[model samples]
Target: MFLNLLTLGVLSLLEGRFPARRDPGQRPLNMAIWLVNFASASAAPLVMGAVVAFSRRTGLPAFPVDAWPPVLAAAAYIVAMDLGECLFHRAQHAIPVLWRMHSLHHSDPCMNASTTVRHFWGDVLIKALTIWPVAAIAFRPTPSTLAVYVLISLYHYFSHANLAVNYGRWSWVLNSPAYHRIHHSREPQHYGVNFAGLFPIFDVILGSYQVPDVTPQTGLDETPRGLFQALAWPARSTPGRSAAQGVGAALKAPS
Candidate 1:
C-alpha cells in the first residue's frame, strides 16, 4: 500500500510538471481504471494463495532453490520470471484470444503512470493462471525475493509514464519509457514490438526492438469510452465477426 502511494505520488508529480501530452480529460478514466485494477490486485493474493496450497497438495515438481545463497537465488528467480513474462507478453500480442483481453491496456491513448492500471480484469485472471504456476513448480522463490520482485515490477507503472526518459546506452539492461512507448505506438510497424517489462534485452534478442523516431500516434481509433466499455470490450463483437477477428484487424503483425 505504501509502495502504491509512493509510486503514484512521484509519477503524478513528474507527469504534472513535464507531461508528454495534456490529457486532462483522461484523468478520471485513468483513475477509474486504476481503482478497478487495485481492487483486482487486492483479491489476487487469496487466489494465488489457494493455488499454492493446491500445488503443494498435488506434489508438483517444485525446484528447491532454498539451499542457494539468498542473493543468487533472488537474482536467478528475477531473471527467469522476467524472461517468462517477456515471452508471455509476446504471446499476448500474437494470440488473438489473448490480444482481445490485453487490448484494454493498450487502448489508453495517453500513456502515463496511470496507464499501468488500465489492464482489464481478465488480465488479473491471466496473471493468476500463468505466473504462480511457474513460481510454484519451477522455482520456489523466498518471500523476501517475491516482495522485492513486486517492488521492481511496480516500476513498470512508472515506465508507462509520460516522462520523456530513456536509458540511452543502457536501454538493453533496463526498459525505459521510450522503449515501452514504442510498443504502445499505433503504427502497424510497431505492432508486437518491445514486449519487455523490466528488461529490454529480450526484445533485443528477439528482434522486436525499435528505437522510436518520435513518440508516434498511440492507442486505437475506437478506444472504449469508460470503465464499463473497457471491461466489456472482450465480449463486444459485431454481428458477423468475433472479437478475436476485430482485434486481429487492429493488430496486423505480431513479430
Candidate 2:
C-alpha cells in the first residue's frame, strides 16, 4: 500500500509538471470506481492468501528448477504472468459478457494513476482468483517469489498514469504509459489492441500491437451514474443498453 501511494504521489507530481492532456476532467466516475475497488481491497489479502494456498496444492505441472535465484525466478514468473494477462485482457474485449464488466475501467475520461484502481470489483476478484492461480500452479514459485510478482504488478498504477511517457526505443520491451494509454483510447481504431500488461511482445505475437502517433480521447459513450450504479452495472447490463444505462435501470427496478 505504501508503494502504491508512493508511486501515485510521484506520478501525480510528474503529471502536474508535464501533463499529456492539459484539461483532464475531474474524473468523478474514476473516483467512484477507485473507491469501490479500494473498499474491497481490505479483504484482498485474505482472498489472495487462500488462492495462494490452493494454488500451492493444485498438483499442476511445476517448473523443474525449485532452487533458481530469486531474480531469475521472478523474471520467469513475470513472462508467464504477462502472457496469461495478455490472453485474459484480450478475452475481456473479445468476449461480450466480459466486456460489459471490463468496460467500466475504460470509462474514465481523465487518465491518471488512480485510473489503475478504476476496475469493477467482480472483475478484480475474478482475475485475482482465476488468473493468478493458473500462473502460480504452473510456476510453483516460492510464496516469497509470488509476493515479488504482486509488488511488481502494482507498477500497473504507474503505467496507467496520465504522464506522456513512451519509453522511446524500449517501448516494445516494456509497457510504458503511452502504450497502455492507447489501450484505453476511445477511438474505434484503438479498440481491441495493445492487450499486454507488462510486456508488448504478446500483443506483437497475437497481432493486436499498435502505436499511434497522436494522443486520443478516452471513455465510452454512456458512463455510470454514481458509485452504487457502477457497482450494479455488470449484473444489469444488456446487449442494447449501455453498461451504465443497465445499471441505472437496475437501480430503478423493483428489488
The model with the greatest lDDT is: 1
lDDT score of residue 50 within candidate 2: 79
C-alpha TM-scores of all predictions: 0.87, 0.84
lDDT string, candidate 2, 87-201, tens digits: 7777676666777887777767766787887788877667767776677666767768768887988879878878788876667788878888887776655666777889887
Candidate 2 has a TM-score of 0.84
In candidate 2, which residue pairs get closer than 3 Å at backbone N, Cα or C atoms, i.e. clash? none
Q: Estimate the overall C-alpha local distance difference test score of candidate 2.
A: 0.71
Per-residue lDDT over 1-255 for candidate 1, one digit per residue giving the tens place of the 0 to 100 score: 678768978998998998766753265787787676777777776787788878878888766688888998888889888887887777776677777777777777778787787777877767777775576556777789889888888889778888788777777788877888888876766776778889888878887776654676567656778888877877767312223323443334444
Model 2: how far is 106 from its true place, Å?
0.4
Task: List per-prediction Cα lDDT, in the order shown.
Answer: 0.74, 0.71
Candidate 2 Cα outliers beyond 4 Å, as residue runs: 26-29, 42-58, 235-255
Once fitted onto the true fold, the runs of candidate 1 whose alpha carbons sit more than 4 angstroms away are 23-25, 238-255
